[model samples]
Target chain A: MPKLPKPPKPPSYSEVRGTVQDNVIWKSIFRPGSIYRKGYRDTSRDRALAAMNNVLYHLHPVKVKRHGLKLTYTYCLGGLSFFMFILLTITGIFLMFFYTPAAGAGAEIAYLNMRELSTTVTFGALVRNLHRWGAHAMVFLVFLHMARVFYHGAYKPPREFNWVVGVILLLLTLFLSFTGYLLPWDQLALWAVTVGTNIAGFSPVFGDQVSFVLLGGLEIGPETLLRWYVLHVLFVPFITVVFLAVHFWRIRKDGGISGPL
Target chain B: MSDEVQMDQEVYDRLIGEGKSERIARAKAKAAAVRKSKIEEGATLGPKPAEEATKALEEFRSSRSGGGGVATKTAAPADGGGGGRLTPEERAARVSASLGNGGDSGSVGVPAASDHTHRLLALVPPAGIQQVQSKQQDKVYTWPHLLLVEFVALLAAGSLLLVASFFLDAPLGSLANVNEVPAINKAPWYFMGLQELLAYFHPAVAGITIVGAAVLLLMSLPYVDKNPSAKPENRKFANMAFTFFLAFWGILTIIGSFIRGAGYEWVWPWVQGLGFVL
Candidate 1:
């Protein structure tokens, strides 16, 4: 290829290398500067890059001051809620490899996993059990976390956005618990969900509209299992992940946790 | 103005007076001024629609207006830390710095004894300010203590649930025949509160009001009780009120679960009765 002409540059001004006495304004909105440094190749690193280049990331600081990361400011309950969630996620995935969602086979498969596959997996039942309990624990912890945050006034200023996000997380948690209730495909799961979805239908604004929508029928049937199974396994988890991102980000942006105790 | 500023001003004024120079700082400013004058010249004297007025108000809010004013001057010292924790070296240094060479220095920059004490007290603010009140207030998870508790509790609950699931086996009644009504048709524990409501009130009211009230309380709690004084001792009134509410709801839920007949009308009535009785 033939040599192409270089684009013309702006005319140069006299360079002022040394510090000047006057504070002259430098308007350089057009040409941006590198404002961030790279970090360890973990979560914070992704955050820092995101903070600079992304509004969503910018909402949470890439690197938190060690002081803010301390558990006391976080009110342990929220952290514990997250801990339970991770525990649930791990246990849930393991349960999935063996457990089927089909009404006929779901509970049977779960039983087989507990009796047979569990022996080889060695704490496999422990895993399924943990996942099951973790769901319940998550609901309890999330409620307690909301209470703690509420009483402490931690949900006010700076943390308001996160509080809204937390509400969604709480709803998702309840969803997670409810859906997990059905995985065993037992009567408890069946009735619990039937009652739960019926209550959902009671929403006056939507009412019967809501039940038919979620249950996929006026009453619980094969459709309910498949629906709750999909929601528990796929849908709610996806929504929870999105809200979780906003939740943590808002924490950092809300001034790296609350203090002035 | 300084000599340089005056010189620059006169040069600029002379140039402007001669109509040879123009100055409106940014392109945005120039654009705004032109539009403003155009509007003023052709302005109609009429009341605007509410929506139009709202749009105007929003446009005003979006514009950045900078002006002159008094700035609040409560300059905090570096390291907004209170004087609580102390190192030997720091303590010695601070004492020496305050006392000043063991009284050799005439004016140690210390105030009257009362004033000195007040200043120091102000820094630490007694036990009231420094203490976070409840352990929950600190929110810090001492991992070992917390994790152990979490694991144990979760493990225990998990174990119990598993055993219950196995032993109870969740009563596989007929294959969920919707057409055949199961006698004593009832809701689960979690839904018991609402189901009990459906018995008395319209399902619309039961669903909307009950859940709405609970969600409103939970979500807007931070807004409802916005006091910053969360110290347990300081927040005694709020703490007590909250505790009472929690206890009331908890007691009612348990009781309502059993006496499903009255359908929660008694729950609120009793709570109201207690208020008047007290």
Candidate 2:
């Protein structure tokens, strides 16, 4: 029998071969090895590699114990807190574009900016609300996460250091909220911060100095607004990010979420 | 194979750091390697001969029972595991070896599941995961399990905030006038607890001493309690104490938030119209 003509073989992907398909535009984006090969075994090692190789996924363990994954056990309160932080960061940046931290006239410039943001700027109110609510949610969720950790006795033994770090994060969260409280320069913001700073004034030794430093003077005025604006925008976020990184790294060091004994 | 051996060494060292016996650690590493090799050889490669399977199971069982292993926790060094007398120098050597050769310094904290839990839940893999032998428990890859859940939560929380933002603008009271402070001025809900404390004690006592003491106590909990176990049942006293603290915080916050009238006076929440509810 006469042999049929052989079909052409596909060229290889190597640079040496210089295949047309290899130089295709899409190939540049989704390179080989980016996705796992088909029929890959879900073995323990494979799972470990999957987690270790990814950036975001690296926060989690390859194979968590069933007990640890239970919604009731963790309630994902820590995750919620983290999500709120991300939301606040994004919305806070959006807010900074419009807000002016100046104490001008009866209707303060800051208050006018806020009013404009709420009533005029497109989706401005949404961004402001998200920031406001996210702040509240983060404060609530951080405390809830702490409560969950306490209830589960997860702060014991190998996990002790992480718990201490978490407590510090909680304090940082409150400071973030308090510093942010004065940003709007409204009656609510003014009196709330005054009440808060006045408490600082009662601290005996450094009370007056502390309040003075916080207000940038003895009273809540332009200096106070400027000081708070810098704190809310620049200083607090930087410190929070640093501590957050440590808090997460320590969790990975102390073992995945604590489970049954 | 070399990579697996390196990983095994890392695990063994970590276990040792957690106070496990060398013998038990070796057995666990061996069992894990066996499981890995079996997975690498696909199930279609053919079933294990009955005699070999029986022998493997018997060896695994013996190694576990003989080496003082339990379901969830490894044998405690102070209790059942041998090598409780491991010299400090030996431990330091093991730590250095693991740190040097493991190549996994940054990759710690994987909780190897308890053998009993693994065996019982080994029947079915969680959704979206590739199939492996059932010897491992019902495990799901974290990509889908954790990250997916987090993404969904982000969307849920974001949308909720979106709707809320539309209906309820963030509160911005009239422009600041220090001389005309609102009659019922109060701090945010969170600081309301502290504000309530201020009403009861001197500002120094309430703000600095009491609040500072609470924070310090919280930070030093693990050191102060000294309980090694993570189980809730074993931590009743600590739980009760925290519950009381939370109750105090909650009640004080409520008083500061709602019960206090113009002069920070106590008024039943019902006295105010339901419209006063936040």
Candidate 3:
């Protein structure tokens, strides 16, 4: 009564006469044939598969035109600008962790925090330098990208809307740089922003109001620092990221970097 | 017969042969056939309005009947009447019609003589031509090529920035004091061009009016220019205008960065200065 039929055995690799290797242990670390799952064929097909399967690669088409591939044609200025933006974002976040944006804290305290960050925080100096240099580079690169588009006569017809968006992006990039200029609370940052905001003061009917809104007062001080802080850290960055997404999407829609008409 | 009368006759004869009454045929022919000239004719020559043509045709027919003149016997071939050779008179009339009309309306397989008409037609292309252009145009995929170029560009820029960061610490002056102003207070480098403009022109003009106007104009360039050509060689005026703008910005930026010193005074780059130098 207690004797039951032997349970059916599960299939084993040995039954298939395949040599058993410890591929399972290695499989956890490396995916064997994950890319060539359907079986490797020609290079062209593999390249196509690589582009189709990968998220980043798929943003591009399967093959670029020969002229489009020319380094000088685009100089990849737009890409450099974007890459620098990403670098700035990363390093900027790191700087923020150590940054103190107290409105009441005198520029002395603000400057002290920067010094402390460089001396105390690990890799803090590198992060700060990267953010600063990358930001400057981005400004230059974006301008170069615009120049390239202009000279290539790429803004004609279908690309008109994208060009307008790009112009807006250019203005936004400037705003980003200007807002960040006030963060260090150093003399250069202070006077530069003061000069910039003063230019805003010259707007016809909005002059006084613009300056008042920007500086939070008649002059740069605690409130100005606070306002600039929020803009640099929150508002400007958020807007930039949104516009950046649109800009990249437009590049694809506008036929991927302009070449000969 | 006068050329005009002969053309009207040939066209009317062809149209009447298509089972139309003489009055109706004359009106239809006038609406459809273009009169050829040394230069290409404009598109305004189409058949007259139905009411006007009918009225005019009725007047002509009544006058002809009143005059008691007999209508000539014309050999108007039926549609697609292949191998029906034209009589000598018909052949001469057809040849003369073709020559007068530039062969566009009467002859099969002969292209229109006017390039301008083809160009005008190109403005509203046939749908099939659009697909043909896309197929024939040289194009490359964006996959490996675009992505790879982007990757290489990023790597190069990143490396250069990394190196520059190590050598050049981001500039930070003493703590800000609203009570005091820096000797060479200036806007960011990109805005240096406008700032330099402020030096020469009134702030309102330079800062607000000029800059604002320039930006608006730049934005409106594509619309206002209205030239369909993209090639620089074909657009000399546009190219020169843009180049002038670029040169102005470039020159101003340079002057602001290197030439201008404390209190916005001019100084050579090599001159000893107590402030920022490019």
**Candidates in order, interface RMSD in Å:** 6.7, 2.0, 1.8
* lDDT values, one for every candidate: 0.57, 0.76, 0.73
lDDT of 2: 0.76
Q: Pick out the ten consecutive residues of candidate 2 chain A with the lowest summed lDDT.
A: A31-40
Error of 3 at B142 (Å): 4.1
List TM-score per model, in order. 0.50, 0.68, 0.68
For residues A74-103, write the lDDT of model 2, one tens digit per residue. 888998898889888899989999998988
Candidate 1 whole-model C-alpha lDDT, 0 to 1: 0.57
Which one wins on lDDT? 2
Docking class of 1: incorrect
Candidate 2 lDDT tens digits, B29-59: 6666666666778643357576665465345
DockQ of each: 0.10, 0.43, 0.45
By DockQ, who's the top model here? 3
How would you class the docking of model 2? acceptable
**Compared with the true structure, what per-residue lDDT tens digits does model 3 show for residues B1-278?**
23253245677888777788877876656544445431255544556666665465345444444443544233545334222344465455445444554322544333445443322232345765555235454655454466667787788878888898888777777878778877788877888898899888878888899989988887777678777787878878888888899899999988887788888899886784534621
Candidate numbers sorted by DockQ from highest down: 3, 2, 1
Worst 10 residues of 1 chain A by lDDT: A30-39
lDDT of 2 at A214: 92
lDDT of 3 by residue, A78-169 (tens): 87888888888889888888888764543456678888877899988888989887888889998889888887888887788888888888
Fraction of native contacts, model 3: 0.76
The C-alpha stretches of model 2 lying farther than 4 A from their native spots are A1-49, B1-139, B274-278
